[model samples]
Target: MDNLLSSYSPDFPVASDGTQTFDRDALQERIARVRTALTTRRNPHGAVAILADNSPDWLAVDLATAQLGLTLVPLPLFFTPAQWVHVLAQSGATALFCAQPQQGAALGFSAMTDYGGGLLLCEAPARGGPLPLPGARKITFTSGTTSVPKGVCLTSEQQWEVAHALHRGVSGLGIKRHLCLLPFAVLLENIAGAYTALLSGATMICPPLAETGLQGASGFDPQVCLAAIERYQAQSIILLPQMLQALVAATKPGDARLACLRFVAVGGARTPPRLIELARMHGLPVFEGYGLSECSSVVALNLPGAERIGSVGRVLPHRSVRIAGDGEIEVRGNLGHYLGEAPAPDAWLATGDLGHIDADGFLYIEGRKKDILITGFGRNVSPEWPETALLGTGAVAQAVVVGDGMPFLSALIVPATAAIDAAQIAAAVGLANRDLPDYAQIRRWILVAPFTPANGHATANGRPRRQLIQQHYAQQIASLYDTTEHIA
Candidate 1:
């Protein structure tokens, strides 16, 4: 904490929520109060979990826990109730800080005291034993496509190094104000977005998700988000690819309302090259990057002057990227350990992604190595590549491509709205197929319901669970190969 605090000036603003701004001194006071409360209020061994919206107080709790060398777990509001129960029980969290005291109590936490910024500090029943996380300062759970989310254990140094590398990468851009678009529970936004902003001496503007037009897991309104960007004069922001697509459609050519934006980082999913081009055409500077929770946060990012359109940009100085014999993208770096597990035996972490590096050192991601589909004709296909095209049409809301060990590819598509008919979906698929290869094109498809986390068809971040979806719709998928009721 001392080393981290020295990086920030004493009087400069570091955090704000549109109503209050906290300078270094004010922020330090909050951290001290939290530290004092924790030391005097709870057991010394168990972990503490925070369940609240994005606010300055949440940042304070994170800093305080880091200073005390205590384990802190951040819970995502987008998770379902059952997920919350699972995390609390599995992590054995003895304390919680949340906006709603009643909700915390219902989850087996009793109200102890009221922390500032409308957060209630509560305590839970004692666990049977110590937490499984060793030498871990923070435990961030991944919103996996499966039913259960896994916790990634990270030390303070690992997270700080990633933030410092990110600060060094874009220090010349002079991004003074960064708006928090994604939830801070997301490791990408927490480490790369907020931590990097603090290291670079940039003020982080944090607003509630509702205020920024984000609700639940997958709800986003680009118009409301654009209003926040303009209202706060945000010079830099991070977004998911789907959010970027919506912003591109909302902004007109040479839109002056978004003139304040200088750097927009898009990641958390594969971004189509056309979306990046479209965003630039609308006067928004969108840079694509890539990373996962296991590598801390950001591994590579496209800078202002240095960028490759289809690539995720060059690897950062802190990490090294190499391709395996099977063409899997493996990263050699100081990675964190998985919760309740031992350290990795190997030096390089196999990132389950298939990609290659260019001569100039830019990294391009093809798709998930496990999600790749092999056809009967022995042609390898990445569903994400074609799914990106299908989503680009703006008429298809959700799509899952499945054709492993089959003659041709097939898709289960959900239209943007109920007003869209079979003819509209066929036209959209045709438009998407025009750019794809002959073997990769969707020869047959069926209109289906939306895929969501609540339905076990997708992750909290909205990435489809291919295997589970395939198992659930095995009969439907089999019928697609048959000659009956073909829509496309």
Candidate 2:
């Protein structure tokens, strides 16, 4: 069990301060100090809830927790105060690590730290000990069907297997300098952007907030991300589908800023093949991937040399996958424990996703098993398929279809660019309908605002919170069926 920190040398690791480059040796040393504090306190099996934004200190504390064998719960910075309180209490965390003093004080955790108290508080130290190579590790609290959220437990061994698989799959591309666009709190980015980079001996660059494309009123600036790529000379990066779309739209032909880029891995939602083709035509390398929180991030990915259009690529070497009789994707190998429950020794885990393997072993993801829309005529329609086709028209920003109880499917579309009028959307929908069966066609639609994470309609990685969005716009959807509204 070699510790994660011990793998890296004591020599100064590079860090960005927006202007000058700084060494991370002090950060490593701070981590070591934190580990000592935890050991001296002798609180085994205690849970620590980390309430912090992305920063050097956050990484240090994470490494420290690994060294100390303490369960670490990384809380989302975007959560409301009441949501934070609820999660902290439900997690039964014995200590709180606050990046902001106000956060701790507001929750009354600051006083607990002062009074020989229930909660211990300390600034994340810079140095830490070596992390164990591979063993059981805990990551909890995943977004679930209910508001309470669910905790997913993954062992270090499971994470290592995934990292190794990804490293092998993308080996043909040579070494890569990965720009981490997704938040580190996400398991997908944490393992893929951090662990996988470490496994591949690649440079893992974390851009400053200003350089991360998350600026201005719209929240993320695609231009800043492109500029950072040029500045850092980054060869690879991870993006959600929405971010990828924005980058594609923002980029122009002959943009030398992307000349050095080797691959842009897009996941967290279904990606349209037309979008991928558009990116490739513009000299961008966008590879699509698929996975879930239970799989330690990526289960399948399209790599540089081995890519299949309209597919999520072949399964990684470290895992085994099979399509059930009903088209559900069931997986096994490198399996881990479920949070709040004991680990299962079975060889298979139901992925709850529906997809089929192509003749060449590529995976074509149809949609979520839970989200299949059944028409009144008994035809099965996966909204993702139609949605992908709709997005291909380049006019629709977001589309969600509902037809579970209705005779005909209906869509709620978010038009791209304010200038694009309803006529443009109708034309796109008409084009999409030309290729779909009569039962699968969108009989009607309602224009709406784009779903976003800030508004709770999307996940951190940009996946649609389908049920939430449906609930929020239930009235609008109902109005689409009104007699006054007409559908061509």
Best by TM-score: 1
User: lDDT for every model?
Assistant: 0.85, 0.72
Positional deviation of 338 in candidate 1, in angstroms?
A: 0.9
User: What lDDT score goes with residue 349 in model 2?
Assistant: 84
lDDT of 2 by residue, 1-488 (tens): 33444444565353333443324465556666666655654344466668764455555566677766677767776555666666666655656676556777676555323312112363222213222112446565565444555666677677778878887776677655677776667777777776776666565677545567864213667888888888888877888877777787888776898898887888888898988898887778889999877778898999877889789998887778899999999988767655556667356888878999988889989988999988778888888888888887778878888877677888988886778898989999999988787888888988878776567776666667789989998897777765566764
Q: For candidate 1, what is the lDDT?
A: 0.85
Model 2, which residues run further than 4 Å from truth?
1-27, 41-45, 111-136, 208-210, 215-218, 345-347
Candidate 1: worst 10 consecutive residues by lDDT?
Answer: 125-134
Stretch of 10 with least lDDT, candidate 2: 124-133
- What is the lDDT for 422 in model 1? 88
Clashing pairs in 1: none
Query: What RMSD value applies to candidate 1?
Result: 2.0
